[model samples]
Target: MAVNLQKGQKISLEKEAGGALSRVTMGLGWDVAKSGGFFGFGAKSQAVDLDASVVMFDESNRPVDVVWFRQLKSRDGSITHTGDNRTGAGDGDDEQIVVDLRTVPESVRSLVFTVNSFTGQNFSTVQNAFCRLFDTSNGKEIARYDLSVQGSHTAQIMAKLYRHNGEWKMHAIGENGSGRTFDDLMPLIVPHL
Candidate 1:
């Protein structure tokens, strides 16, 4: 069974999945809100180019590597991105980042998942945005975070997966910010780590 996570909620992956997980995927999805054309004539939906990224951080909260649309994989090959989804069209996850947890370097302490509109479209133009984590071994969703807040911000610091006492855990971080890329999200992410 999948757990719906609230903002700031934390969960132990081991307990939620019934055991240890070797691989997991962070999936992000969203839809573009329709705009009422001149005098409500033609309501149309524009394509939203939202990019999902994962920033690997070390023990001191320093970024070790990042896997995003531009860089599809981490330096060590432990993390891989499923590519960018410019339209946010169709169903399910628009973008996905897969992590081989076992192969992640010991020096990398946390993985921060983030979503941003490379096209500069704010959240007000988006709808039904969400981030989810699932066990890759059995294709079971373990946790999901719905981004229900709509605003002028262009990006969001979605969630964090970190190691705690040799066990993996997840934290829901629904912080909104204005950014077109991962570099712009660095400051907003530091406080959460």
Candidate 2:
């Protein structure tokens, strides 16, 4: 079972499953909103090339690595992006980033998951946007953060997974922002890291 998390809510990964998770996946999904048409039959919905990105930060809150469409894997090879999904036409997990929890560098204390519209469309043009965390071993969903809030912002700081006292926890952020890529979201994400 998965918990629908509210903004600012936190949950310990180990406590949620009664054991430590060796592998986890952060999945992001969304859909293109349709423009008006007769009876909503042939309405044209613009194809949005929204991107899912993960930024790794050290204890000092400095960015250490990133995984996205361009850079599909972190330098250390612990984090890997499945691939780029240019269209939101899929059923589930339009983009996925797999993390080997045990292999992640000890220096990297936190991982921030983010989404941005690479084609300039804002969240108002998107629907059913979501970010979810899953335990890879059992394929069980642990938590979900829905980015269903419509707005003019082009980006979102979806969630963050960080280590505290040797335990891993996840936090839902769900903040609307304006950016086309990870680099552009750095300023808005810094304060949150």
Candidate 3:
């Protein structure tokens, strides 16, 4: 049973999973919108190269590590990105970031998940976009955030997972920005940290 998360909503991962979570996964998915088609006729869908990234931050809100398409794993080997999906053509998750919760460094106080269009395509050309969290061991979905807000921004700071009283929790950020990569969006993401 997964909760459809609203923007700014927060949830306790431990309570949602019925116990401590050993490993978790953040899955990002989306689809390209079709254009130049008659009513219900043949329309050509544009290719959207969206990248999912996890930025690990310390108590001081300083980014300590990041796992993305280029950097597939964190320095400590606790987090790993599945791969990149150039075209959001298939169903389910287009990209996945797996986190071994137990192995995540104690110094890391928060993990921010983000998505950006590497090809500079804005959200207006994307549809059915979503970010979801689940237990990697059993594949039980815990929470899902719909990234369906269409706009001209090329990136979205989707959600955050932070430690609270020795437990992990989730917060849906749903902030939009104009950037083609994580480095370009760092300024916009710092305020949320």
lDDT of 1 by residue, 110-173 (tens): 9999999999989999999999999988889999999858898999999999999999999999
RMSD, candidate 1, Å? 1.5
Question: Which pairs clash inside model 2?
Answer: none
In angstroms, the error of model 3 at 12 is: 0.4
Relative to the true structure, candidate 2 reaches a TM of 0.97
Candidate 2 regions off by >4 Å? none
RMSD of each: 1.5, 0.9, 0.8
Model 2, range 99-120, lDDT digits (tens) per residue? Answer: 9999999999999999999999
The pairs that clash in candidate 1 are: none
The sequence of per-residue lDDT tens digits that candidate 3 reaches over residues 1-193 is: 9999999999999998898899999999998988787994998887999999999999999999999999999999999999999999899999999999999999999999999999998999999999999999999999999998989999999999999999999999998998888877889789888
Give all TM-scores, in the order shown. 0.96, 0.97, 0.98
User: CA lDDT, every prediction?
Assistant: 0.93, 0.92, 0.94
In terms of TM-score, which candidate is strongest? 3
Model 1 alpha-carbon miss at residue 55, Å: 0.5
